[model samples]
Target: MAIPKSAERSEVGAHQGSGEIRLVDVTKKFGGSYAVQNINLTIPHGSYCCLLGPSGCGKTTILRMIAGHETPSSGEIFIGDQMMIGKRPVERGTAMMFQSYALFPHLTVLDNVAFYLKMRGVGKEERRQKAEEMLQRVQLDHLKDRMPGQLSGGQQQRVALARSLITNPKVLLLEEPLSALDEFLRLKMRGELKSLQNELGITFVHVTHTQPEAIALADMVVVMDTGRIDQADTANVIFDRPKTPYVARFMGGQNVLTGTVESLSGGLARLRNADGATFEAATGALEAKAGSPMSIAVRRDRIKLRKRLADQVLSAVNEISGIVDSTEYQGSYIKVTVDLGGGVFVVNVSDSEYFVDAVVRGDLVTASWTTADVHTLSKVDMGAIDDPYLDATQ
Candidate 1:
């Protein structure tokens, strides 16, 4: 059967306040293995949250359970004051915008947007007026008479958004909402989604596997690994101070370096690589035992490349010698990949800086950063943390 065109409707004032989502010890299991394991999260009322991970990392599973499409194997979900596990999705005060726009090909945009009200036994004139207001809100009123086949990808998406919002849901759930659009349309609609969410003053829980989409759209980003959350925090915290190696790597823009701790002195933990090149990072209050494996993340733009400083005295802290692996000329910045024996570092250089002293492949260079710039990362299970999106090509 085609997926249900409409969800059950709820009273408007019944869910007036911000839609706060609370998941308590939530788990979803398929057979003997868990698809989503013991997830406990609180999405603030009216906040924009993104569940970001690779395909099969359980982001969608969590979203489905929250939407009441699938019941959790264990634990409870609360949207506003209502327990959602046994309740119908509409009863939970949420409307989901599915990955596929799922618009009816035979219906005009007006009829499609009003289908939910129609199912609720609303008068034709009243529903049409309501749907018209929604279409105008999404800036698609001009296409109201067009069939789904007649509208563009962006237009169809607007129609979908209107249909979902017409329910007046307190929490709007989106599952891979932008995956259907082309690159240009996806970007344009991304901004619109955020703007709409703000204008409505409602919660938006978006599920996506794309990294940039999560970081750019979410006020709160929950980075997940296979069946587990690697990190969940505000966008700045998740991106700037990643809690684990997987987050640092998955979020992109940072280099993950692994080495054995050689010594600890003056609040700095010294780590040595395979070729004996060592670097120092601030240990803060965290315990660092000698010979234990430790990892650190340095932002791509934080690193500086130099021609070895051949004549000057040797360096202080956070410096490594490496051969230039390759250089990519990005419009605003150049990405220089350096091979440091056992690891690779990507240094992002401004366009002006790149043209001044462009280093090519095989050039001996020293990549240096600061102690304060380094962020320590907890060890992650390599088998679980490996990116499926990247693995597909390999």
Candidate 2:
């Protein structure tokens, strides 16, 4: 199959910078339990790769191993051409920005940023000049003299950022760097961090549990589960064409309908659900013989809702009947919960016409989606896909 031009461009972007990092069969074991297991992944140079998983999924351990703060029990870590195994955190050309800004309360912003340069034994005047430039880069130069206590959460975050970048490390490791800020600041800083990475042309490996943050900042997303990489792909592929049941549910926003593949041909599959409801889906890469059981996922937003008695022309598509059990009025969308015997599905309507009052409890509604929007899963249920609180470390 011919690759699309956009896909080719994305591939090129993923390979930029020549500052490649590889984790070869890396594992960190603690007291007979594996925190990270046989994990092998290649992060392209200059790519913004996010290690995304729930707490204790070993993302932080992987970051620490790369930073030389923690050593891998079994595999090797390579940065560009350097082996980082026995090096100290400072020896490896890497910098870490933690969730806490960790700025000094007594030092001004300039002094905080210049502190690193001073440790390298640079002249005081040159170090201050470089610190001032970094402050300007983060748009915090105007607050240079203000102590850490005088700066807001967002401002202090910028100071930490400037401090880390002052030394021009080869790889910037950010471990929930924005997790400490408020919602508004976190959102704003996501953009700022992305811009900074692009401008510096440096390899950035950020670890976070927030799916939205990973989707917004990463050029490549590494989804980890049970101490191994479940899938590593661009944000679009990881979210849209997830390769596993764990990934489908972990990414959220999708309804996984398990069924048997009754027939397959011409890029389409006929699926019969456990509850005996049959649906059609476009199977692009999935291969299954007739009578084989599989699961299909469709995002709630992709499933269109129709009032049972409305006269609007119904488009020809797969459909399911359910009764509204609950409704929530979200400012931009109305979330209607429909109980479909075997499971419940939540669908969102962006049009204000379908307000919370549009479908009251016990109102029968039909949810529909085209074959192209349905995603096929080989073996998994909604329970495995939607349970974000599952112990990923195990």
Q: Write the per-residue lDDT of candidate 1 for residues 1-394, one digit (tens) a residue.
A: 0112243333422466559999999999999999999999999999999999888999999999999999899999998777878998777889898888889999999999998889888899989988887787776778899999998877888899889888888899999999989999889889888887777678999999888888889999999989999899998898888888778877877777777899999989999765666778888767889988888888888988887645554455677777889898879999888887665678898998888888999888888888789888776224324445632210
**C-alpha RMSD of candidate 2:** 7.1
The lDDT values for all models are 0.83, 0.79
Candidate 1, run of 10 with poorest lDDT? 1-10
- Find the number of clashing residue pairs for candidate 1: 0
Q: Candidates' TM-scores?
A: 0.91, 0.86
Each candidate: how many clashes?
A: 0, 1
Judging by lDDT against the true structure, name the best candidate: 1
- Candidate 2 structure lDDT: 0.79
